[model samples]
Target: MGRHSPAPAPSAAASAAAAAAASSASTPPPRGGRAPRDADADSPSAAELRGLLEDGDGGAAPGGGRELSYLQAVNFAGGLLLPLRLPSAHAIHKRPSAAYLEAGTLLGEEAGRLLKLAGPLFIEGITNIGAQLVATTTVSRLGAGPLALSALVLAQTQLNFGYSIVCGIAAAMETCAGQAFGARHYALLGLILQCAMALCLLFAVPTAALWASGAMAPLLVRLGQLPDVAAAAGSLLQLMWPVLPLLVVSETTGQYLLAQGVAAPASVAGLTSLACAVPAYWWLVGRLGWLRGAPAAQVSLQAIAAVVVVAWRSARDARVARTEPHRATWRGWSFEALRGLPTYARYAVPAAAMLCAEWWIWEAVVFLAGLLPSRAEVQLGALGFVMQVSIATWTLSYSIGTGAATRIANALGAGHASNARRIFVLACCLLAVANSAVAATLWCLRHRLSAALTPDPEIGAEVRRILPAAILGVVGDGQVAVLGGLLRAAGRQSTGALIHFCTYWLFGLPAGVLLGFVFEWGALGLWMGVASATALQAVALHAWVALGLDWQREVRRSAATVGALLGSTGATPTPAAAPARSFAIAGLEEDGLTEEEEDGDEEGGGGGAGAGAGSALTSPAGAGGGSGLTSPLLGGRG
Candidate 1:
């Protein structure tokens, strides 16, 4: 009744008019005191305006959070599990950690699948010639200098350092290139490609030269290793040194090809080296009897072949590099490109150290295993075979993880935080499902697999007994690979390096040694220790990425550091953007481009306005407006 009586006045419009007039009177007008249009009147204040920009700007997408499609699930499962079955057969025996070999299974499988599904069209379009060499065959077979052989084997030990450096550098390119590319910066990609090539040449060529000079031997000696092995290693290093130019060219060009979604070059270079090197090694050393001392001779010939193959490959690569499009939009080199040198240096140096540390630790294990009683050492060697098998599995994980890296890196570069979060989640789910299958398969094949690898019944039995733990260790380690990749994708190498250091040095190694040597737990202890460290590392890396730490600042910081290093090489730098905020990926494309390219686009985009970074080259998604998911993760350290 009271409301009805009050409503009798019906003064709603008048009341509103009066309130509006009063509110307007309370606030001062513009300088000219003219009435404003609705757009201006509705325009938010500075704080509100900031929020509006933040909300509307497309740094993160809302609709495309990752959800598993049947194809993705199948793809993930096949990638994760098949490598468990075939890794050792591929590249397990030669690598440092085998994590990439294991994780790379996904990449191999994907490559195969793409070729199969899309046929020659896919193969021609997506092949990576450079990667083929690394992934398909052993580089040690490429050359024939006794000194080169030593260098190459020793070089294998240095691969981790090289991969980390490559990944970091490529990522910088991806960031810078992605933006320029998206904004139609063709000229930038071209310039960046040249600058990057020069940078790679500067370091890689010199490194190969020093490696060949037998100078690397003293370094090993400094590390407190035996003189005999070091001497041998040094000899091998010298023989392999001549292939340095090839290696440098392969890596740098591979990155360029992968970044541009033209991975056939990487695969081709890889295939050429592998095809020529492997057969050359066996034919020259094993059949032809080129030199004396089986291992040394074998190494020498391998180096010679590697050099020839690599040299030829490099020449071809040079032609390709020269032919790349030179767009007119290519702008002048910015101060940012030079400025980013320090940022990359800061990130890369620690990463390299961590890589070296991890490699040395494993080398110590292999060496120590050699020193054990003959029977124990023999058993350890058998265990080594098992480790190889496990590593092959890890490559699959690495490939998948790198896929994750590509997605995350691409999303960030594209300023799509939500998409990055989605990619992260999808990767995690795929890893778990894949790892679980790996555990099951390893469990089932323990008896047969062990028997096949060795003739001794006792050794086989022992291997069988520890098989479960080993597989478990692999699963855990594979997960860590993905997480580490995630960190790299986010341009958080320092965090990843720190996690790797703590896990491998403080946790994995010490614990394994204590268990294997002190407690005499043997293979089980070693496997358990590895498992423990992997678990810890996975957790730590995931936490860092999952927490969505300040990525833009990381971008800025990394840029500054990388810029500083390149500046010394005569590269210019660009101005820094406002620091990025914390971000997470929710959903991602199951098939983003190769990990390096994905990151390369973004890295290249933001680092400097390089010609390659912004060129109107084909995107990862191909020519279709498909999210261009073809960028490489730049985290293919495996």
Candidate 2:
């Protein structure tokens, strides 16, 4: 209600839609000697009869808007339902085995880093802000019935946090699928999909169970300990289930595109959903006045039309992608797809948990805020705005992080350590420069920004007080962002996940609450927690990057844990472990072979993972690769 991060700027689909309109022939040629009647075609005869119907409506009533041409119509339709179209198109265009893993690896690495640091922090801000908005708007507009709104916000917050994990899993799927495509392991892609499906199915149960176990209102009341809050949360949670499948589909589709270097649809989906959902929310609850119980029902019913159009188009596209079904290799549900399940699940589950941990950190902060005075409500709202602003900008970090992850993984898998190092340097430089700019802007705007959110001077004051610390968190947030993406990309997701859990949950949230409420620092204290946690995570993420992830351990754990699941589900058994090859951080130890031998081996059957690690004292490639090293390298102090 009060606003958060300007709803992330109209998304790729919206932009495309607008572009199609502007570029295409705005008007249609005469049809029936006047205009084409396309919008209400019942059938072929019915279509012909449409002329009669139009005539019945008094002289062909000039077809409201010009009918779009085939291309224009397709583009327009795509924009209208871009989320389903773009993602589905990607899956169709690149079958699992046909994708490029190196590219995916690069993207995944970057994505992992961005996700680890910035991603979670970004969402925390979003959910916190969302809670604040619901609180503030409800108080502003419907003081008497604000409790229902609060409940809705709490429920929404939980669902919102939960949805981020769905996004992560989707990314994991996209990354692996992309990699398998590159490696020409077509079956691997199927395996990844199979495992992802199994994992998604597996995850849905636990997450749903957790939602149910929370007892909805009681959980909210206990966390916030507010009676009105509890009631609102319960009602909201009850309605949340219907949205789960939608969330999963949306996230998976978006991630699939990211793997293919397509950002528009995912971005568009986010923008469209926020823009559409927010207003739709007002219409269902505020205008229609369905406050007594289950706002989700009203929401689900309203969304049906949009869903139908999108789904119908998606189904059609999927069908079109496969002209003829492959012979049933093994009957009912191809067990062969199960081959990659263990591998994907191994990476995905922790990746999902890592994502969940990051989200929970902010959720904890909001929980802490609930314990404070109602004035804290305004503070939380203000925090949300700051966070959204940060995240919208953070998208750039996600792009870079995804790139790094893909590059690092690809180089490593292909045995190119130097390239991986160079890529890492590039990511840090880009992220740092971008973060600095955001910080400067925040500093300049802090004063004027707070007053805009509310009429109350007290709320404004609290926001300004917390603004500096919050901005500091934003900077640290960027570092963590790339680091997390890099880790996931490099197959070091567990390390990143551990760092997140420790920093946010173990340290940050608690510290913020204690300082804010216990010490009477108020909103500023809450932000202090954010700064502290982010700083801690930034240090750890960088450290892990400097000292590479224990891939051996990761691979082993992934294999062991995922193996059983895959076996039970009829997926392939684990492949034999390769001989461990170790190198210093710079990827130095060569396997000693002639150039011809190297080339031959590279193309031969004796394939292996990425280059050995070591710091290369080699000159930077065009100097872009080493743009941000401030201190002296090789152990010298600046």
Candidate 3:
């Protein structure tokens, strides 16, 4: 996966052919001696030639000379002009019904589309979390000792921290692979999937080593944890070491399929795993009295998920090869996967930081609960219960967010800026409605839910006391999740990381500490502080999207991102022109010129025709014209 060499310059014959075609198309025939009607009929019109250029058709021209492919013409013209000279908003609106579609009709259509994608995702998220919930419950049934419960919490926290990194890498894949699939750049999807899997597996090495080394127990003890609890946590962590690689495979492969709009396999697999896990946990832990059973059952669940997803992938490939062979995504392993490492890291690092920032803040709050002056164990139990409820509710938002990101990425990749903007708007609306309903339902059932979760009156009472604040936090968290999706779709994870760091670390954590410790507000105050920060975070993200986002710019950036991946893998026939069609069709569709309008504009040598030609000649391969060359290929909005 060494750095790709630059695309070769066009051949002299191809260059001459392109020059001849451009001259023939642009220059007018002599007025004094018009060609006969028959001859005129045989010769291609200026509009026809333009169509050839736009469509990348491969055929002989008027003079029996070979015509350049669309990409070849782009490369011949120059590389930097194509992406910069996009159509204006007026032109975009000119497409039939593009601006005329009824708002209700559009919203209804988009809502259905979003729900289609989000449904399977929601099911998968719930089932995945359910498996973990079953493990936790089984562990609880072991006894009332704080040592086992505390150790399980500690071990699970550590596992989640590492797993979040894997998830971040998978999220990057959602951006890259989804856009590539949307852009009809099918070859790039396989390569991106491979890169994600490799990176995740590579990451698992050090994480697994740390878990297996038994260092966490001593570290936790030094950090003021009881020695017995830390030792039990360490042992549990060792038991969980093998699950890391399985998780990497499961998460990465599941995301790969999800990027392509194939979610049923993962959802079904999750359901099966959950069904198997509950019974396994009961048999191993409840009946057999094995402390290691909880971790063992978790490992089995992940293994099932990984295997099922891989099997589905293989079957999908076989089916695609037999039916739509040309559209097949996988092309076997290659060094090309290595070439994409830098690009993967460009998104993955910030995505990891963004998720870790939020996760660590919650973990910090949990630790804060442990530091209470009295009734620390009860407080910890209550906080844990509230956290689980919050996470379960968050699954709804996560599903919606993931669906939004997928749609936006696909729309931008296909050069549909208006559609992408619509998706963002619709996703926000859906998030609001869904979260509002969830908040109301939870508010009504807060007491019953708390009682169902635990038998301890003290823990149940504490949970009920904090439920209102946690519910508010869930609403804010839902908004933040969807906004984060917008950022991810646009490859703006670095910005997301900054937002999380500021909101969680600078504001949320500090506020929680001050209120929980200094003011002695306990768990309720800590949750209130987090809820306030979440609301602030959501507001900030909303303002950024409303004021700062440029959909047209994102469309161009998506082209570059996909183009860079295609170039790195050598999958595109003409690396230089890979991104050209992405925006070329966009410009054409946005301009909304009918055949007659095109002819009239060409005769006048102005308006839409001139703009289209100028756009092509000046901005080849979706590269922006003029000053756009100054922008880096992979650069995106911050």
Provide the lDDT at 450 for model 3.
93
* Number of clashing residue pairs, candidate 2: 49
lDDT of 2: 0.47
Cα lDDT, model 3, residue 280: 86
What is the TM-score of candidate 3? 0.76
lDDT of each: 0.46, 0.47, 0.68
Order candidates by lDDT, high to low: 3, 2, 1
Best by TM-score: 3
Off by over 4 Å in 3: 1-103, 143-145, 286-289, 573-634
lDDT of 1 by residue, 1-638 (tens): 00111112212332333355457546776895443321101222345223322322232222111111111222233323222111222231222224334545544443332222122212222222222233223333444544434444454565445544544455444434333333233444445555555555666677777766768778888977566557766665565454444444444444443333333443343344445554555554455432222334334433543354345435544554466433232344454444345434444455455445545666656655554544675557567767666766766666556545544444444333333444455566666787789878888888888988788877777778667877877767667766765665555656666777788888987898788777877766666776788788777766765454544333222232222333333432232222222111111111223222322322112111111121122322112112222332122121
Output the TM-score of candidate 2: 0.59
Number of the top-ranking candidate, with lDDT as the measure:
3
1 or 3, greater by TM-score: 3
Q: Regarding TM-score, does 1 or 2 come out ahead?
A: 2
Question: In order, how many clashes per candidate?
Answer: 161, 49, 12
The parts of candidate 1 lying over 4 Å away from their true place are 1-186, 190-206, 215-231, 286-340, 357-360, 371-375, 548-638
What's the lDDT for residue 620 in model 3? 19
As for lDDT, the candidate ahead, 2 or 3, is 3
